[model samples]
Target: MRKLPNLFKFDEISDGDNDFKQVMVSILKKEFPIEKQSFFDAFESEKYKECAEVVHKLKHKIHLLGLEEGYILSANFENQLVNNSFELYEDFVIILETIENFLKNI
Candidate 1:
């Protein structure tokens, strides 16, 4: 598993506004799990198009979390999903799990 970066981008975006940071984190806390489930449901059902859509949403989260490499991985995975290819599935799952654990301890 790759080491996840600190939320520096999020901090910078929040611009020292703690309320803004909290709100952003709150949104991520609420959305990531829901989106994660949606991705699983779509992937398990072989609904590649749906998976792609969820991944598209997830990519933004990846970017927001300062995960440039993860964002790239998800972008490739999203594109591959269009052709029903899940070659990067496990790698993407690692990213998801990394984020999940990070969120939990934060």
Candidate 2:
């Protein structure tokens, strides 16, 4: 697994409301895997536009997780997918996996 960056934007945004934080985390834990699988399926099928759409959805989660740089990369990758490019695919996958591992441990 890649190194998890020290991210707490979600914590800051939740305003110390543990209940609200838990709800948001729960939503992410449930939704992320489904979006990830959709991304993989679209990628495997060579549906670049569809892949872009999934990335679009996932990028919001990236931002919510306090990954400012990752969010920018995701936005760029989303655009690349729309243009049928795979140049940043590996880097983007690393971000996804990092988030996956973080969510699992949380």
Candidate 3:
């Protein structure tokens, strides 16, 4: 199995303030699960537009986590959803799993 990158840009978040880092981590812990579920629910309902919208929202988190390739994959996935392709959905799933696992360790 391929290992996910250490994507969290901790130094960027840390930037000297420990409190800011803690707050950011707290927000991520709270928000990411909800966002993940929203994405899954939208996909399950075949609401491709809603999936795209959720992907758009998640793109920020992808970048914040410093998953540059995952970020690009997400953009492509969003476009695929918009086009009703569904081809890249599996890749998006892998990305989500990678993120979820990474979050668990932090």
Candidate 4:
């Protein structure tokens, strides 16, 4: 399998402390699933506002993961959700999948 791009900013996180890194990883591990489930539930139920809320919450995790471009895309995706636009759904899903895969490796 192809190696994924680095999804973290180690040097910037906790000043490169290993304990801090572990804490960060643990936090992401715990929170990602909840955020993802919320997103899926809202999306499946056609609750655009709820979806937007979840996306907004996930956006902070995206930035913490050092996915700068994904962060920008997620902001757009959140707005699209608020507007009930499906135009960017596919792209947003791709980003989510990438993050999920990356999280697994970490």
Candidate 5:
């Protein structure tokens, strides 16, 4: 079986010259939360309006960043939330955590 590589390996969120980790760090610094905690906390409330908005903005940026996988994952999250599908909360949380962890490195 062929294993797929992590799709967030490269992007244009920051200067193209910078590598993956650097670009992620740059994005985080520019964004509200440079770490995972704030990112998670944004979705930890009933007023998930901000979360949805961020997802939308990030979804657009992800394409420019060339991170279709993350964009797709985030879109699913937004979709489920918008449609009141919280049954997969735990599973989504795992995916979100994985995204945050991946951002911690390249």
Candidate 6:
């Protein structure tokens, strides 16, 4: 099961009803696989622009989901990739799959 506070700080950030968090989690669960496939396909095609764009958006949701370490790591990697660091692609593969699983469980 997904951890409460760790999955999100909704207890403190929301009105005890998890309005925002619930919406985010629902969207994430629904889009996880599509997003995962998109990332992998982009990476395989070396389409850094598309991959970075998608990952940048994913980072925002991840930050709000309370996966701060992952949010930071992914955002940084995406930024680097967009700026010109193709070397980060391999590392991104590992983190992307991890994040995909993390969100899927929600």
- lDDT, candidates in the order shown: 0.93, 0.89, 0.84, 0.81, 0.54, 0.69
Each prediction's TM-score versus the true structure: 0.96, 0.91, 0.89, 0.87, 0.52, 0.70
Per-residue lDDT tens digits for candidate 4, residues 2-62, read: 2233635754767868898888788888888888988999999999999999999988887
lDDT of 5 by residue, 1-106 (tens): 3122253544333336567656565665466233234445667765466666665665554444445565676688777767656554565455545555554564
**Can you tell me which runs of candidate 1 are displaced by over 4 Å?**
none
lDDT tens readout by residue for model 6, 1-106? 4222145454456556678768756776777667778877887798889988888876775676676676777878888878768666665566656666666565
Q: Which candidate has the top score in TM-score?
A: 1
Model 2 TM-score?
A: 0.91
- Which ten residues in a row are the worst by lDDT in model 3? 1-10
User: Of the pair 1 and 5, which is ahead by lDDT?
Assistant: 1
After superposition, which runs of candidate 2 have C-alpha atoms over 4 Å from their true positions? 1-7
| lDDT by residue (tens digit), candidate 3, 1-106 | 5546463476576887778887887788789889999999999999999999999988878878878888898899899999998988898888888888888897
- Residue 94 of model 3 has an lDDT of 85
- Which scores greater on TM-score, model 1 or model 6? 1
97 Cα displacement, candidate 4 (Å) = 0.9
CA displacement after TM-score superposition, residue 32 of candidate 3 (Å): 0.7
In candidate 5, the residue pairs with backbone N, CA or C atoms under 3 Å apart (3 or more residues apart, or in different chains) clash, namely none
Residue 62 in model 4: lDDT: 79
**Candidate ordering by TM-score (highest first):** 1, 2, 3, 4, 6, 5
Candidate 1 yields a Cα-based lDDT of 0.93
Per-candidate clashes, comma-separated: 0, 0, 0, 0, 0, 0
RMSD of each: 1.1, 2.0, 1.8, 2.5, 4.7, 3.9
lDDT for model 3, on a 0 to 1 scale?
A: 0.84
Native RMSD of candidate 5 (Å): 4.7
Q: Kindly indicate the candidate among 4 and 6 with the higher lDDT.
A: 4
Q: RMSD to the native, candidate 2?
A: 2.0
